[model samples]
Structures are given as C-alpha cells and as structure tokens.
Target: MEQRLLAAQALGENELLDLASQRAKAVENWLLEKGHVSKERLFVLAPKVEAATEPGKDGMKARFALK
Candidate 1:
C-alpha cells in the first residue's frame, strides 16, 4: 500500500494505478508460473472481486473487486 502511495506521489495517481495494475499482473503471472496460486484464486479473473469495491476508485479492488 505504501509502495502504491509512493508511486502515486512519484508518478501521479493514474500512473501509479497503472503501476499497481502492472505489478498485480506480474505477481499473478509469477504465481501462475510457479503454480503457487490457482487461477480460480486470482484476483484479475472474471467473477472475481473488482479492484474498486471500496468507495474510492483508488483502492486496489478497482481491478479485481468487480464480479
């Protein structure tokens, strides 16, 4: 969370969001590659939580909080 905030400060809110998105994708890919996390448990998948579940669009759920 701190990293995202720092990135937002460094790169602006939109860029920071993109950065978080990229990071999430990277982590998801890595987990999939390593077989540590199942596709069903992945946050980016459909029928999953959207990244914007909270009132603020800045929340991480904006990407995976929507189902």
Candidate 2:
C-alpha cells in the first residue's frame, strides 16, 4: 500500500482515488476469503467525489481536519 501510494503521488486526483479504491477492495476481498473478518463487520465503502475548492477564484477555501 505504501508503495502504491508513493507510485500514485504524481497521478491526478481521480486516477489516484480509483487506484486506492481498487487496492482497498482487494484487501477487503482477501480478508473475507481468509475468514479474518466477517462480512457483517467489514463493509465495502463506495467512493465519493467532492468538489475541490479553489481559493481566491471562487471565494472558497480548502480545509482539512485531523481527528
């Protein structure tokens, strides 16, 4: 996953997300197949795309919060 992320760093947003989603799905499938986690406990999440805020252009700002 680290390697993938590093390789994908130069990719555009949509492509990077698609690659990450694919990797996540693969991991989920492997966990399910190995009985490491149950289907009821683990879920596959659908990807969501949010509009990017362009500061100074649209009077919108980008913010990220870490919990």
Candidate 3:
C-alpha cells in the first residue's frame, strides 16, 4: 500500500485515481484468494481504500486525525 501511494505521488490526478483503484482491486483479490477477508467485506472496504488514496482530497491523515 505504501509502495502504491509512493508511486501515485509521482503521477497526475487522473492517473493517481486509476492506480488507486487498480491497487485496491488487486489487494482485494489477493485477500479474497488468501481467505483473509470475505468478498462482502472487501466490496465494502474497497471504496473506502480508493477514497483514502485519492489525490486532492482530505486524505488518510485527516480521516484518522493525524498531525
């Protein structure tokens, strides 16, 4: 996830969104395959992940009340 975000930082806004979406889907699929998380749960959380990684938004720092 950190790697994905770092790569996204070097990209344009649209590309960042695309990268985030792709990474989220990849992670979701991996988790599903590994039985770490259920498909229903992944579906619910995937949007949130993409939103958090999204550029020009509030970001995870604000969401989590970070400094």
Candidate 4:
C-alpha cells in the first residue's frame, strides 16, 4: 500500500512539473509575440552608390562597397 501511494505521488509530481514547464513556455512565447508586435518595421534601402567620377577628382568613392 505504501509503495503504491509513493508511486502515485511521484506521478502526480511529474505531471505538475510538466504542466509548470508548459505554462512557462506559453508565457515566454506570449511575451515574445507581444514584443515583436511593438517592434519597428525594418526598411532596407538601396546602397549608396557614389558616382565613379566626382567633379574635382573624377575618382570613385567606394564608401559602401564591402569588398
């Protein structure tokens, strides 16, 4: 009888722990969604392309060129 009771108690504890973990995950996802909802929209503009010839030097300014 005591052994059976202990087994039942362990099962109940495991279920409670699992429920708590799921609840925590639900709360985290909710918070993340809310945060994303409030975030600003990101805009990707065309890269700044300098003219290959400036008025004074006639040289290309590779300011935005990665390579």
Clashes of each: 14, 0, 0, 0
Tell me the RMSD of model 3 versus the true structure.
9.5
The residue-level lDDT of candidate 2 at 2 comes to 65
| Model 1 ranges off by over 4 Å | 1-9, 45-67
Scored by lDDT, model 4 comes in at 0.43
> TM-score of each candidate?
0.47, 0.48, 0.46, 0.36
Model 2, residue 25: what's the lDDT? 77
Model 4 lDDT tens row, 1-67: 9667755654343454455555545544555587463324322222343445755553233221111
- Order by lDDT, highest first: 2, 1, 3, 4
lDDT of each: 0.56, 0.56, 0.51, 0.43
Clash list (residue pairs), candidate 4 = none
* Best of the two (1, 3) by lDDT: 1
Predicted model with the maximum TM-score: 2
Model 2, 1-67: lDDT tens digits are 9667756654555664676577667777787898578777876565543444665432222222211
Better candidate number, 2 or 3, judged by lDDT: 2
Can you give the lDDT of residue 57 in candidate 4?
Answer: 57
